[model samples]
Target: MEHLAYFDCPTGVAGDMCLGALVDAGLPVDVLHQQLSGLPSEVRFTLAVQPVQRQGQRATQVLVHPQGEQPHHRHWAEIRTWLAEAHLPPAVQNWSQGIFQRLAQTEGRVHGMPPEQVGFHEVGAVDAIVDIVGTCIGLHYFNITKIYCSPLPLGSGTVKTAHGIMAVPTPAVLQLCQQRQVPIYDNGIDRELVTPTGAAIVTTLAQGFGRPPALKLERVGWGAGGRELPLANILRLWLGSPPASALTEPVVLLETQVDDMSPQGLAYACERLREGGALDVWIQAITMKKGRQGVLLQVLCHPELVAPCEELLLQETTTLGVRRQWQERRLLPRRLVTVMTDWGEVAVKVAEYTGRRVNVQPEYEDCARIARTHGLPWKQVHQQVLHRFWQDMGQES
Candidate 1:
């Protein structure tokens, strides 16, 4: 079973709040401390977790207290090196570094400097580092396979930072949101709810931002913030297992009909679309209005690529407009396995449904390459690859 986590951020999200939620969801504090102890000697901090009430809602509050004097400002290169030298798990190290990298890039853009040269002020503190790294450690400990989050709530008014009083949602926070195209709304709260650390953490780690997906309801963890507000100042984390049927994901289908473009142009357009990240691109002959012979072009891609794909079609083809629709496609879990054949090694695609192997086929590209190299018939090479795969698996073809 795959474990999934959903961040329902009605108030907002921060690195520390994420850690607290993970802890409240049953992640052991001792485990977090033990793993965090692997950081460099210069990094010194301790976690403090306690039950807290936010606007009458019970939640866990996690605080990262600096243990000793630490640098008030650190460059991105310095933090990157420290994380690389840490003795943490590979996944933890990668994720922690990725979060900080996003922060550095966003700050660099705001301050007109390179990412490596950007100096982190408030986020460079030992406490923020613990919040970022500890959050990764918690997620790794829970074995979370997928993450979903709600649209972030943006607060109003200004906030005090190491750089002095800055506008609410700050420059770095707004830049991060814009980069990820994260959905945000003003909640009429005159405070800085979503900090730069919070924005960087969620925007970097979350796979999608919207309503939670269909899941078997499990435990909910509430991470409380540091202030009281009209609403509960808490970040809610929903953890559960999604059904096998949830394997289906939403995709965008872009379609256009063209009769003026030459066949070569249409083919070129299709290739460009494929190179631009379209999952599939194809064309079919069709009769348009007035009995005109035309071709219907279709492109399948993730929602994020819809704009670029459409732009490519418009620029590369004679189509005046592209029709788009969202679709949910159920997909079989598949993997590639290499098999040794007489000519060379060929890859075979294995597809599974409901945990049972449903189909197996040799990759045509791999088979064709080997066939050309060995001066053998393509069909014969394909058969040999399949035969070798079945033979190695000890199964009858």
Candidate 2:
């Protein structure tokens, strides 16, 4: 299975902190420097590799320094123009612009101005810019096609910044985080932990947030924050093959025989079971103890939700008792990938086995759309999509 890059943010991540960690993870700092070589005199930086601890674990953190005078606030248009024309790689520039765009929107709301009308306050500073741009370049070097982040720990309380002591989680940070499912916690570190720029970069670049998946472990890197604390100054990185696509888990299958239940009655029971969290519930035809035909009610669900759903089975089905037990099954990791179809953009589900692409099928929504537009049978559209995908892959090969 192909691997993925996972960021473990025990301590909150900052733009500089993330960039520093990527550097520690072996990004080409010298190559990154060469691209930013001739920037205006307002920006200067120092990069160093050092060891730090997080909780009780020791890891390396990259420290960045933007000494001397900082730059003045500029409008989004001006900043974006320079970024667009910069000599940086396309991926780096794209990532940086995305982060900045997120911050600009947040600032716009805080200051009661349009995003373009908002000025870059502390974030516009030369050092912050360098930190973000450097991080973008570093990620490009890794050729990270996809990234997933752990839930962010947005610190609590207010901290002093160029914009005054507004709040611990600044307006910009709060605004950016509100739209995402990233988790926030307050551990009494009443300081500014999740910066707006950092939030932008991490969330924009990462596809989703969750714990590490099944993967073959490879190289791991830790980026450290330059702060000296009782705890460690480190950000952990895990580079490995994603966990096995099919995970082995125990599931309970419930069965009950019904000889006198109406189809509607059976449906009601199944619906209730589903509401109670049965994985699947349906009827199967079978011969009963009296040699009479009957419908077999079956439910497959997690062991935990089985009891609650079982009550529904007893109440709705004609059967006096239900048989239940456990079964082992392998579940695949599933995600929907959007493909550009001749009709338009259609969603297709990609199923993987140990990180290898094993199946790709068009989504019902897409199949229906194609059916309506071309006035063809829905099944035909679906079949065509499935057929075309493999053909396209063959052409690519």
Candidate 3:
């Protein structure tokens, strides 16, 4: 029963489209409105969801009609204050804050100003507020634990903005995707598809971007873009659980036997493998041919990293040949959650299966660093973090 959502954005994605798709996927409008009611804004607006035809297919369009105030510029401080005063759910508040933070930081980089000082013009308006906040509320309501997205469509042509007409894939959008390593491409539509608001939300929240993952396909939500295009201009959302039979992908296993590499060199090679994107690396004692003792260096990596990982083994070890194999791995859905303790903040690795949490481990690096800094035993720091996380979880339950 693990829940996941995938955005299939062939046309592109925007804040409104995301909200619309979520609404279309069965998130109640009343609940969305209730949660968004606390936003510290004087402007009044209505979220209208209606059926629309995109190209030849049906989709949902969410239109915002705001009264009393038009789009206006807002500083980072102003938006931060609004979020803080809104009294959102803790998860919603934290997630929404991170999206806006990325937006401001991207804007700051594009405009040559500090992130705190950057002003959001087009994205600071009421509609943008509704889109971002509504999206968060919808996600919270659904209790979605995993998000995957298709390669984003970055349309071309100029777009009018508060700053003036800027290039397609506006500076803020470009910077956001580039910084996050989110993939983007042009489909030659000659229109602006991905807006800063859309980019910020997706880049901030998406765990991976590519083709949709293997899902059970429970419900599909199509979010419509504002413009009509030759191609279907809609964002399709897929919601489901991981396929019951498989939650695994093939990974490359690179192994080498080393007899002469120094301990310092072996450690550095392991470090290099990790830095080069090896999923894991380990050394094992073994007997080579002719009863010669050797260390077996094993590297596990994504298929894409096989070459670099193999090269490191060849260069860093005395082994003449590196063995490669493809191995399938089944993994639990996991993420890092930080727990604030007296010593400091420690990240707990949380793993879930069938929508139930199965294991939670405090990150050793955080515990060790805190132990050294506070002159406490590492075990004590670890125990304190574990205790704090369970206490918080208990209260939430």
Candidate 4:
């Protein structure tokens, strides 16, 4: 089964809430402690999980207390140094770095500075580190490959920050949402619901945003906020495999017979179709009614993009009419991993089924660029990448 985690943010989300829900879901506290042990000795914090009632419903509240005075401001480079020294898994390290990087970028843009020079105030603290890095470790422990979150309820009014009191949906949060294209809405509450850390985590790791996918019920964990609010003030996490029915999604298939279009135009049309969000586009040579060799251009895309894709076909190709139909697609659960090869870092596309990895292939574009740059055969580079990938997987296993 494909393992997935869906974050239900009815009240809102924060770093601590995400971590608490993940820990409460099934991650062992001891394992979390062990994984976090790699952090520098200067950073000390204790994770306390307490049972609380939010709006009369039981929830897990995670409070992270720093052991001593810590720097409230730090540059992105400093944080990266700590992560580089840690002996965490490559995946965890990458995930943690990415989240922080997104935060840094947002902060930098808001404060008019480069990302590496942007000083993190609330996010630079030891507790914030634990919340982010700890969350990554927890996700690794549960082998969570995909995450989905609901549209955030960005509160109204003002929120106190390092830069003094600012409007709700803080600058950092707004930048994060815009950069990642995360959906956000104000539910009329006048307080900060989505924190910077929370925005960074979700924007960085979440693959999709909307209602939970169709999945068989497995486990549920409720993570509570700091104080009681009008709403539940809890984040619900659902862990489960996608339902059998979700294996395929309805998509639109557009096809048209192209007997007169030139090969050049066909190539350009394929590129435009892809650029216009077509899932896949190709041509099949066929013999039309009068023994004339013709080409059939097929475009596959989301059902919603049918009109735009069809328009592009008509605008770019010499097709008078386009036939469209809704089709179901069964897609494998896949993720990309970058592996270090002799040439450089190569991204490997991995497709998994039934909880087991079924296919691993190097990204063709990366291999082609490497081959062209190094004056080597693309096939040789491909083989070398596969070899390195297997070697790395073997070592990790």
TM agreement with the true structure for every prediction: 0.77, 0.62, 0.69, 0.69
How accurate locally, in lDDT, is each candidate? 0.85, 0.72, 0.84, 0.85
Pick the winner on lDDT between candidates 2 and 4. 4
* Residue runs of model 3 more than 4 Å from their true location after superposition: 248-266, 272-278, 281-329, 332-397
Clash totals in order = 0, 17, 0, 0
Q: List runs of model 2 lying over 4 Å from the truth.
A: 1-3, 38-44, 52-58, 67-69, 243-397
Model 2, 54-118: lDDT tens digits are: 66676666555667765557678777887877777787788888888877887888889899898
Output the TM-score of candidate 1. Answer: 0.77
The Cα error of candidate 1 at residue 325, in Å, is 7.1
lDDT of 1: 0.85
Candidate that would win on TM-score: 1
Tens-digit per-residue lDDT, 145-218, candidate 4: 77777889989889778899999889899988876556678777778999999999998888656666667768
Reference-based lDDT, residue 142, model 3: 82
State the displacement of the C-alpha of residue 61, model 3, in Å, after optimal TM-score superposition.
Answer: 0.7
Report how far off residue 334 is in candidate 2 (Å): 11
